[model samples]
Target: MPEPEDSATLYAELLDSARRLSFDLRDCQTGTDDADRYGMTPEWSPLYGTPTWIRMSEPERRRLTRREVTHFLGVAIWLEIALQIVLLRRNHSADPTRPDVKFLFNECADENLHSLMFVGAIEQLGERHSPLDRVMILMGWVFRTFAWEEVAYGIVLAGEEVFDVMQRDWSIDDRVAPAVRRSSHVHVVEESRHMSFARQKMRDRLRGVSRVRRYVSAVLIAFGAHIIAKGLINKGVYRGLGLDWQVARTEIGRNEHHRMMFRRATAPLVEFLDREGLLNGLARSIYRKSNLL
Candidate 1:
């Protein structure tokens, strides 16, 4: 209830939330059925599927494809590792006075597992390209160095901006299985709370920093998030469905909705940065071009 700082309380909440969310999600966490739960046959894979199945690909996918919904689970794995590295290296050991910050660490473990399950779905794709390569590129230059607030905000925004809508409708996707749907349900419910907590933390913690620090971190965060999105959301799906992945991403970018959601998703961080006086001229130009405002 109190305004959060980079202190013990934040750690406490992070621990509490992580525990509840992790416990609740245990049912869907089992990876045994993940590969089979969907209609994932080689026939279902655009790679080897019947012409009829390939031809009948959904418009949303044809229009804005991503890897199997399950793969998102896997990508979540690297993200967790990346964040944990940051937390462990940067954690204020004495800050354990706050229950929330503890929650962040605890939740990080669960989130890591959740993301691994998602990534497992991706590995199932058997791409000519390595998802690990994509993961390394995104994590190194993008997510590695950031003000924790930006990382916190980015996670919530990803959930609230994109996946919030995605989780609900994916149940009907021929690509997703019932078990995965059950898992995603956990993500949807728990992440909704996580989003609120992350956003709240952003609002509370990101203030009062030097304007320069705020601006730098925001730009960095957005840049990093964009790279991951392209790799995961853009390239990952097209290839999974056996399409010309590169061409499809280019084509889908022309779609108004995806572009809009992207901008909207990253907007809060941008605005937060702007208020902190971090928007350099180049960053401003980029943000304007992003058309997220």
Candidate 2:
């Protein structure tokens, strides 16, 4: 709760927290899925009954739909991670006098690795038009708004928190084939710990900041993440198929049938922090700032 006059503790905390956060993701020791696999588990996903009327074959549409949804969202995830490194790099590149170069270097390396995986996923989805690419390009810029110091870190933390649960839920309860399980397993493995680290990092960051700023930023990050998720769902996908925008946005932004599906999307961090005995601060209050409460 001291004012964060020096970024040194933050540097150590960020690294330590990132490492700890990465642990569950790296190891995935205790994972699970929703109990129901009748394809209606979440009951709270914002993306329930998405526009499924494309002309492609069902299997092809399934793969493509999942791929498009995953690839773009993953870009937000990877690029957000990338920008964190970029922020450090921008700071360090010009000021050789900056002492935190070592930490920045570590951040850059991790972001690069994460970015590569995300890029590979994007490439795996074949290709898209210039406009879709433009949407993604613009999204990267929007994600930058969150990365402006603690806000960016918070958003990533929230996102990693979301990623851990959704992937875990999908992986656990479903009796999918082994090959597909890796898809769920790989993500759950890395993101779960990433969420943990983000939680601690936020906890540590709040040690010295104001409650107002803390509360504001936490809601901002959560709302921003929600907005980004909403945008990623897109009106065109649904409206183009003759679905109402209200119905579409509600489904992607606030529906019941897929709630549990995306519940993990918001659950891990809450559970993690609750278990850590680290929740009574500004960040804790921030957790309750949104409808997620």
Candidate 3:
């Protein structure tokens, strides 16, 4: 458990971090257009290096990549919405006078802004409808009702960290669309603070947590991570492009480059979970299935 003073100091540092990273979205040029039609680096695509990718026409590849990026941001928006609800519920009864409580409010506001930015990107990229969007909405409502503090926070941490790795790449890669790259850069800057806060909260939640509880929490966390991993790109994307969604999903699974990227991206979080004894037993197996181990 963190000392009161320690927690307070952490919150102060987080507030400083947030202030330093903050930006006004109105000033950002969010207009995405035909010029922003480039695909991600081959390595970032699930079908990269596969026979399928080699056979794809340049236009088809570009369309898929653009749709995939749109889907990615769409899922991110959903995840942030769910996270905001979970965080709000966690802090529902918090002492408003505390610095930590104020920080929670600030974090919620940050997530709201992020949601807008993500929505803006999707709007600019032409919306791709997916059945998974409805599922995500239902899941968000269901998950919000339960204040599974440790489990919920762990999912948030895992999701953010995984995307942070991908976004870091896009933020610097000139080949990526300018709007996509700029949005990523903005998110990377702001989310660094949110990620720091989540890590601290996860650690605090795990401190002295019982083995039985840890076991249940670990499974739940892995399950959540798996859903998030699979949810990033929905079948609707492939279907919209006149391709077989099932085949695309299968090829993505067989794409070692994609699998390795997931494993590498999640390495830090997995190591942390293991050190905290939250990555043992069933949790480890589940992560392996998700290619996150």
Question: Among these predicted structures, which one has the highest lDDT?
Answer: 3
RMSD of each: 6.3, 7.9, 2.0
Which parts of model 2 are misplaced by more than 4 Å? Answer: 1-57, 60-64, 70-74, 89-104, 127-148, 169-187, 236-247, 250-254, 271-293
* Residue 216 Cα positional deviation in candidate 3, in Å, after optimal superposition: 1.2
- Per-residue lDDT of 15-120 in model 2, one digit per residue for the tens? 5655665421222222222212222122222443554333344443343344344444454455456456536644644454332444555555655555554444
User: Model 1, residue 147: displacement in angstroms?
Assistant: 4.8
For residue 130, model 2's alpha carbon misses the true position, in angstroms, by 8.4
Candidate 3 yields a Cα-based lDDT of 0.77
Ranking by TM-score: 3, 1, 2
Query: What does candidate 1's lDDT look like per residue over 1-293, in tens digits?
Result: 44445544545555556555553433334333433344221222222222323455454332222244444544555565665666555655636535555556555666665665455444443322335454556455445565375554554354344454455555456566555455556666666655655655565656677766666666655555554455445355556555676655554556555566556555655665566455677666655554444
What are the lDDT figures for the candidates, one per model?
0.51, 0.48, 0.77
lDDT of 2: 0.48
Superior by TM-score: candidate 2 or candidate 3: 3
Evaluate residue 216 in candidate 3 and report its C-alpha lDDT on the 0 to 100 scale.
90
What's the TM-score of each model vs. the native? Answer: 0.65, 0.59, 0.92
Tell me the lDDT of model 1 at 170: 54
Model 1 Cα RMSD, Å?
A: 6.3
